[model samples]
Target: MQFEDVKNARDYIVYSQGMHSYSKAITKMMDLYLSYVPYVERAHQEGKKAIFCSALYPTTWEAPLLYALDTIPYATGEIGRLSDFRVMQIAEDYYQFPIETCSMVKCLVGQWHIRKDDPGAVKRILGVSSGCEPFNMAWETMKMQGFDVHNPDVIYRAKGVDGERLENLIKFFIRQLYRTIEWVSGSREFDEEKLRLEIQRKNRLLEKMRKVLELRLKRPYYIRSLPTILILNSGVANYFARPEEFEATLDLLIEELENIPVDEEENKKVIPLLWVGTTAQEFGIYEAIDQAGGALLGFRSSPNKLFREDVPPLEAIAYYLYDNQRAGAEIYMRRFLDEELGRINARGMILYGIIGCSYNSVEREMHRNYFHQKGIPSINLEGAFQLGGPTGQVLTRVKAFTEMLS
Candidate 1:
């Protein structure tokens, strides 16, 4: 498929013109997303390997490593976002993947099938065996298709472990990072200074992101909900490829938010909501919420911890990944949700996820019960991630939820 045929490129262009059209910063972000695939293709022409990663893996650890290896990083989840239902259909219909598979995995495999014959496209996948079973299975399937797949076993048992065990787990993960580096670069030896510089650059980007989040908190409507979601999405994966360009876009957004005036009358009419669970690949989810008189003030999945500068760089990455994985536990999520709800003064919650994700299926009831005990109103919305736009049922449910909140 051509670049223009990608769903995100088309949607992002419409988004650029439709919402907050006055802000050149949002347009710059749209351009960044549009430029990503071409950038990877260009790098491939330069003989750099394009390595596929997952959003589940901490970019804090992987981004620096990929930089040091002189490779380009592209997440399948990011590709899923760029694709439309046609890719998902390819996975479901042609590949014979069960309809029960996670939407992102389907997109991942489908995208690979489309580009597997292309010499310049992604041929190497770097995956972790820890999170999301479907993603692991996807990697295995791609491996069966003769793609270069390296999935390192990183233990994710972060809860109920003793201090010694936790320390051991961190050491194991650090070793796995080296193993992955060796697998990608054909050697374990990488420039420590290059990795350290990439980490420093990542840290700077994180600081700018924090500023953007703070600006959103100060004036949620000033920036709008979709842009906030996109920002968090891009920030999660270290801007997909180019950290410097992503950082520049954040700088632009921060400046625009600081200068723009909050629409008080409009803000007064909109109910502030908190989004908890996986962000839907369907961009229309945010738009639906906005049309229903709700604005997503904060995301539960937003990064709360920064890499530790006081520790050794590798150790910091290990700890960050360990802590980050631990935060996915129910214990951490409960406290985090409460803090975010209070922080943003959100009136309601939107619990959203893909239809076939086991994690979301299990967490849906738990989250609903938890919010119930806290007397917070929430609505659960489940659908295929990138299969088309938001369903009418989803839009009606959102409208009802926001009306109830109002």
Candidate 2:
């Protein structure tokens, strides 16, 4: 059921407020779905089993098999997009968490509370143990609400801090991800060689699809929803672990989207920024930014359409596996960054990092320094979906930056 009217409220909160507000914002948004006190019946209802995890971590990791047995295990926004306000209010009203907690947490707790009533409201809640506090806080909060929030121990088992270690970490996560999920789902683990072949296959499809993004960025005037290229990258990468299926989807999506002449450009002002927050769907910040003359160029993170062409059960060989093999979250963002910085002509960037996400925070620093040194007008404005901007403090920074560019 498509709830067109049910615009992802949690997303709006995060977008509007920032990552600090997600805990409360997400809960508040989910509040609208109930036929009870808060949420009146709406038409557009998305019934997929959703799980929220760190984009960087999720791409390079996987939830255990138990989550896959019931969940459509996946990560949420790149940043500041998924906030549960009502739930945060609930948590705040009761617990009085300090100002340091990321809004994503309160929102997750609030949502879990609701899910307890509707098992299908959300079956699985996977939290990443990225930073010190959030890892412990998230599980404790969920346990308080009685929800099975799975935390994957994706420790980078390699030595050194060089890119090789990073690469090793990526391989490590991908290798064990599915086996973990399989174990969770009461199924036998996949052979390592088979999973390795799957990663190679998906990587090839990623290579092809990235070409389309290159074309679109090089010529945005012809592409409609150019951001879809990034979104599709996430979708296709995650859905099909095999090469043939990944290619089929990439070929079709690219052929259809890339075919549209590159003669058009999105008209929103604000110099059109792709809100790169880790959990970005909380407060319609992108929409508000667009309202303030900026196009929220959507996510280059884990999208759902990048791999819809070869519908899973249709293309892969009889023995193909697609459950918790997280293949897409690997290299999409790096590619998207290279592509969008060229096309979106972003004025400045926002970090939208949760208070304690080590991987995302590190990625944000890398993104900021890269763009800042390039002199492309960027800022690593930190805020959760629930916290900042109560007084337009962030907008003040953004306003200054916008003026400097103008």
Which ranges in model 2 have alpha carbons more than 4 Å from their true place? Answer: 1-71, 74-84, 117-125, 157-179, 190-205, 219-253, 264-276, 282-284, 287-348, 354-376, 383-406
Residues 66-156 of candidate 2 have per-residue lDDT tens digits of 2224433344333222344666665566656654566666665555555567634544455544435754775776667666666655552
Against the correct fold, how does model 2 do in TM-score?
0.56
What is the Å distance of residue 200 in model 2 from its true position? 6.5
* Candidate 1 regions with alpha-carbon error over 4 angstroms: 1-9, 56-60, 82-86, 93-95, 262-266, 325-328
Provide the lDDT at 9 for model 2.
46
What's the true lDDT of residue 188 in model 2?
52
Task: Please state every model's RMSD to the true fold in angstroms.
Answer: 3.4, 9.8
- Model 2 lDDT, full chain set: 0.44
Indicate which candidate wins on TM-score: 1
Worst 10 residues of 1 by lDDT: 1-10
Write down the RMSD of candidate 1 (Cα, Å).
3.4
User: What lDDT score belongs to each candidate, Candidate 1 first?
Assistant: 0.74, 0.44
